[model samples]
Target chain A: MRDLSLHIIDIVQNSVRADASLVNLTIEISGEVLIIRIGDNGCGMTAETLQKVTDPFYTTRTTRKVGLGLPFFKQSAEQSGGELIIESEVGVGTVVTATLGLHHLDRPPMGDLSETVSLVMSGNPQVDIVFTCKDDKNEFTLVTTEVKEILGDLDISMPKVTRFLREMIEENLIELKLKIE
Target chain B: MTKVKSLDDLKKMREQLQSQVSLRVNSETPEKMVQVKVSMATCGIASGAKEIMNLFVNELDRRAIDAVITQTGCMGYCFAEPTIEVTIPGKEPVVFGYVNAQKANEIIEQYVVAGNLVDGIIPANYETVKDQKNK
Candidate 1:
């Protein structure tokens, strides 16, 4: 993943693949640290699989031999003087947390997050994804469940709905621009 | 944050805007709408697939083209990063590579809208898992 947003997208895809109906993704920037967490109620890994998830060579998917998603995200965080952690149970769920030094030179930019959210939603309309981005000065949260309620059985991935979701995300995140500077 | 007071208020608003919203209850039927799948794996994102996906969505809306856009995992074309598969009604799916915003625009204007094939069509050498299943 080139940016933090893309990293989030990669990790969330794992949850979707795990048969998770809900995924909660959080991105927080506080002081000098940037933090990301993805929690999912999915068919979580056994302790054995969780132990090796960070290994670039280990993958649960049979279609591929190497699963680089977690390893790449771990590398990105660790390169910025931070750490990645995974907590999972066999049938309960899993949560992945990564912290990065925000000001570190190696930290990739926080790329197009609205696009990231839209892509995830478009790809998994049946799943509920709750995304929250918080900084010291501002915070924005979007729950697809709520959006669905507003939409009333109209698919969220429909062109107008997607357009609305993209604009809603972008419009909310725009409040954080002044805070970023 | 304070747009609607309650569920009833939101529902009222939804009813007001429902006329403008097209209802496509099923996104799976390719015969009903143009089906587009953008590869969104890590490599794809690193290669600007995110931007291309957004371009397709926004441009399709601007053109009022009824298309179902989706994001999918890598199609084992890491070398051909930023690839997208477009399936028009009654047509075989075509995968296009190296799709930036410009190429995506060309795809929309030429291939998707006009039914005229443009450049950047990668040979559909690999079969998707879904394709294999249907076969």
Candidate 2:
């Protein structure tokens, strides 16, 4: 909730909890607009569930039910002069997209994304994630499998792994910003 | 800016030495220095890892526990996040999961300060390749 990456992480957790096998996250930044899209091949939500999900008090899980995550995300998008859209098909999949005015002061800061990616890749080793980051000038793709192959059985909990993820994200952002400049 | 060519060069750097020397020179140093690594991976963040990380850092700083806090990626137990790894120098690194502010204090007081293991540990059987090959 502190940043777009945190929101993405929260939503992806819901997807994983829904038994998702594949999750695709796309971030597109152009001019002053930033769009984030996440699609998951998980058990899609029912119409009733979807309607209540943004209520901040409804949750399907029995573990601490007062769900505020999705609502928070929706509010964040709206406050940023953007919108949140969700589409789901029962037994098919789910997709959530949030567009934000990057220059808007109301928009939450982009939190630590390198930590987010590394966490997801390491935590859900069986589940695949395709992450794409793009701007007017440059784009980068990160697939979980490639990192796993590179790391082998080395603990992703290590500082080196975190450093690699941080470096990757920072470098890509710098490259993209340079192109814009 | 001159680039450091080797580890030795890094050891002679201004920032690192200054921090280390200052830490050493400072009086009222705690008996022990607890090194805490907060896992800020995607799973950890989803499970409120940021809040937990901040809580620990603030609490430790408030109490002036000679702790050097940092962050790591994922600890692989997506279900039981936000995970935290604590190392007390001579002791083995212990990873705790589902950490909250309350639990973090207990860790700082009991496990970190008193050397007692709290609950919420993922089994040690979950080994990395280094551990597997060593076995």
Candidate 3:
């Protein structure tokens, strides 16, 4: 992935493919660390599968021979002096977390998060997505269910509605960025 | 944010409303709305398809154009990494090659918005499924 946002997208996609109905993506920036957490309530993997998930050669998908998403993320996190942890229960769900050194030279930029979230939302309108971002300066949460309430019969995937959601997320993140600076 | 009613209830409501507006659903099909497919295979991503995909979604939304944008696996156009296939309503799909941010903007403005063809169109190298069947 070119950026952390892209990694987040990839991870969340795994959740969606796993038949997850609810996915939570959270990004946080502390003093010197940037943390990304993705949790999904889907069919979780077994201990064996979870152990081998970070291996690029192991994948459950029949269409592809290799699965690089988790491995690539693990590599990036390690290169940036960070750590990655994945916890799963066969029937419950899975959670993946990565913490990267905020100013590390190897750390890729946090790319366009609003666009990533927007695409994920539009692609899977039936799934519920909750995105939260926190920095030292501020914190905000965006829930698709809230937006759905505001737009009674209209689909959240509608162009106008998605545009509104993207702008709302981008604007709030910009405000947080400004405050952090 | 505020608490929401049960999702099951909301889904039922949507189904009821959608049934009432079945015509609207028909109107939203691929033949009507603009369809954009960004190549997102490993090769495509290496060539920056992710950024282009992001750009397409944001720009199209900002312009208020009703479009369905999606990502697809490689179309064997590695040379044209970051390829995008655009199909306007009732029109054959057009695949564009080597699209950068500037080229993407031009596509959105001249092709998607104004209905005027821009540069960078890649000719169809293969026959369509319908054509093959007809043959």
Candidate 4:
């Protein structure tokens, strides 16, 4: 992936395909580190599967021999002088926490997180995604359920709502002293 | 700096959108509506499937098309990294590859809305027949 947001969405797609009803993602910048945590309530993974998911050549896709999402994400973090961790239980769920040096020279930009979040929601409106990002003094959160409540009978995936939400996220990130890459 | 939006702002948008927005997703009979499923696997993502997905969602909504847009896992067509499966109700699903924003728009306007065939179709909709024969 070219950017962190692409990696984020790729991982979220895994959760979605695993039939996750809810996914929680958080991005926090503290000191010189940026931490991203993605937790999902989905089909989960077995010990064997978890062990294999991070291997560069390990893949669940029968069509190809390699699955690059987790490996690339791990590489992205490590290259940025950080690390990646994953905890999963079969029939339970999975949580991935990756950290990267905020000022690392090789770190990819944050990319368009608003686009990532909105596309996931619009395509899988039945799933609830909670996104939170913070930078020391400032914090912002977008809970799909909360938005859905306020929206009443409307779909959050609607073009106008999606545009509005995108702007809202953009402004919040800017407020938190971060810019979309 | 402009204020970061809160739910209150969204509430206001909802009020205005109530008049303009279509409850199209809810009003349409799901079984009869068009289903656009974009492959969102690692290969697809690397090739910009997410942007293509966004285009499909917003464009389909804007065109007043009552369609269901979803993201699916790899269809075992790694060669066609960024592929999409479009299913118009009562018809078989067709897989299209190398889709970008332009292709998405064309799919919506011609193939999706007008039900006319377009280029880039993978022709594997008949793969089920091959599978059956193998069995």
Candidate 5:
């Protein structure tokens, strides 16, 4: 909502609630465009649910009547001179891709992305998340499975682990710098 | 710039913690320990629950408390954004409302450590789905 990372966190929560064991988020940038693509190996939706997911008023969650995650993401992309696309199949998975203008003023900043990715890991420790970003020259990726392999039976949700994870991600992202400008 | 992080670095870090008990936290009976669950719905996230979650995780670890901090969905207390449910073993769970950084600190110090009741405690005035199932 307030930032692109927040929207990302929200969308990933949907995948988590759907029991996704794997989630992949990729950010690709060209000259003037940036893409946020999130793919989840969660329980895919029925055609009925997919039809209403972007409606802002229809939600599978019984906790409340309104679901604004997708709608908000779509709006954020379009406001920045881009588009949002969601593709899914029953019993398979779902992928949400939002492309926006890198120079657009309305596009939200990629706020605290390391924290966002870390929080996602903190909450769903068992779920493996692969985060990747690329420009023409720089590329960075964080794969939880590889981290888990190294840690070997340690809980990823441990406070020290999360802190270290966030720091590593932050430094890598900063090193890459994401500026194809 | 700092050295770019790689798995090799984490491998070194793991050796230190692997020797500690933090690795075996859940394996040895979790229900006996404290459980702190922060509401993480869209409303809660927008209201700063993520920061609260980090505080609980880091501060609890700092104070050497053996509590499990986790994230949960909305607790039907939408009006009181940024809520959390704290459950100490052998005690009924209590949901606290409007939890900010200072309040979270008070919780860790007073309620969590000293076992004293604090303000802003939201009564379980209604039954949740899990509660109904148990009944």
Candidate 6:
């Protein structure tokens, strides 16, 4: 993946592919910790699927099955002196959390998060995404509901929609960073 | 650190510096400025544009090339993402796609400096603006 945000997008895609109707993504960056939690109201995986999710070689989709997204995320988190935890209940839902030591030299850069949110929103216009980003000084949240209202029936794939999403994320992050400083 | 009073002050200072720098570096000088645009759109980011953009900025700065790098929104070619548009002022702008760090380096060395086209160009049909209206 390109960076932490892109990796999050990849994992969230797995959730979308699982037919999730609601996906909640939270990113918390405070002190020396960067934590990301993604929960989806999708068909929860079975024990077999959960066990093989991080195997890097098993997938249920008809698409290319060499699954590497989960493993990569797990490896990245651990390498940064953190951990990846997953919980699922069959017929209920699934939640994946990845924590990284923000101060660790091995930790990958946060990358371009604005693009990540835009891509996910554009690709899965039907699914709802609640994205939250928090630092010690500030917090920001965006719900697909607000966006949909702002862009009525307009194709999310349109350049204008993508630009709006990117600007929203970037402007919020800038404000947050300024508050921290 | 002292903060600028207003944007107007910043603009004035920028203009002053611009003039001085222009005088210092004439067009006849061998050191030509290179401008690189990274496609940081949704599609490009999914295809690893951020990494490639960072690689370009870091490598060019480290090498001390007279370059300035920035990002732009989507160019409408989602399939060939991680696209990069390079402009060596006075020459035509070229767009390259599917860029990684390695490909970014090649573009800087081969295309930016040596004036050659690399692989992974999206066909003209997919270009966002049909004509060079902005240019």
- Output the better candidate (2/6) by lDDT: 6
Model 4 stretches astray by more than 4 angstroms: B1-3, B15-34, B61-64, B89-92, B124-135
Clashing residue pairs, candidate 5?
none
Ranking by DockQ: 4, 5, 1, 3, 2, 6
Q: Write the per-residue lDDT of candidate 6 for residues B8-38, one digit (tens) a residue.
A: 3323444443454356455423125666766
Candidate 5: tens digits of C-alpha lDDT, residues B10-76: 8998888766654545353447568788888788888988889889878977976666566777776
Q: Pick out the ten consecutive residues of candidate 3 chain A with the lowest summed lDDT.
A: A172-181
For each candidate in turn, give its C-alpha RMSD to the true structure in angstroms.
Answer: 4.2, 11.0, 6.9, 3.0, 2.9, 12.3
lDDT of residue B45 for candidate 5? 82
Error of 5 at B67 (Å): 4.1
Better of 4 and 6 by TM-score: 4
Compute the TM-score of each model's chain A versus the native chain A and list the values.
0.94, 0.88, 0.94, 0.93, 0.95, 0.92
Model 5 quality (TM-score):
0.89
Categorize the docking of model 3. Answer: incorrect
lDDT of 4 by residue, A1-181 (tens): 8899889888988898778899998998889999999999999999899999989899875556888999999999999999999999877789999999999999989888887876776666777999888887888888989888887876665556666777788877777776534
Error of 4 at A73 (Å): 0.5
**Candidate 6 at residue A66, lDDT?**
55
Off by over 4 Å in 1: A62-64, A136-138, A176-181, B1-31, B119-135
| Model 2, span B1-135: residue lDDT tens | 433132233223334433543575353232245667777544577678866765665566466455645556555566788889888867778888778888888988888778888988766777644455566
For model 2, what is the error of residue A104's alpha carbon versus the real structure, in angstroms, after optimal superposition? 1.6
lDDT (C-alpha) at residue A94 in model 1: 95
* lDDT for each residue of candidate 2 in A1-181, tens digit (9 for 90 to 100): 6677788767877777778899998888878988889899999999988888888878664334467668888999999999999999899999999999988989888776655665555445567788788887778777766655554433333333433454565566565552111
Candidate 5 lDDT, A83-152, residue by residue in tens: 9999988778999999999989898887788887887776677678999888888998889998888878
Ranking by TM-score: 5, 4, 1, 3, 2, 6
DockQ for every model comes to 0.33, 0.07, 0.15, 0.49, 0.48, 0.05
Interface RMSD of each: 4.4, 11.3, 6.7, 3.3, 2.4, 13.5
Worst 10 contiguous positions by lDDT, candidate 2 chain B: B2-11
Q: What does chain B score (TM) in every candidate? A: 0.75, 0.69, 0.74, 0.74, 0.77, 0.68
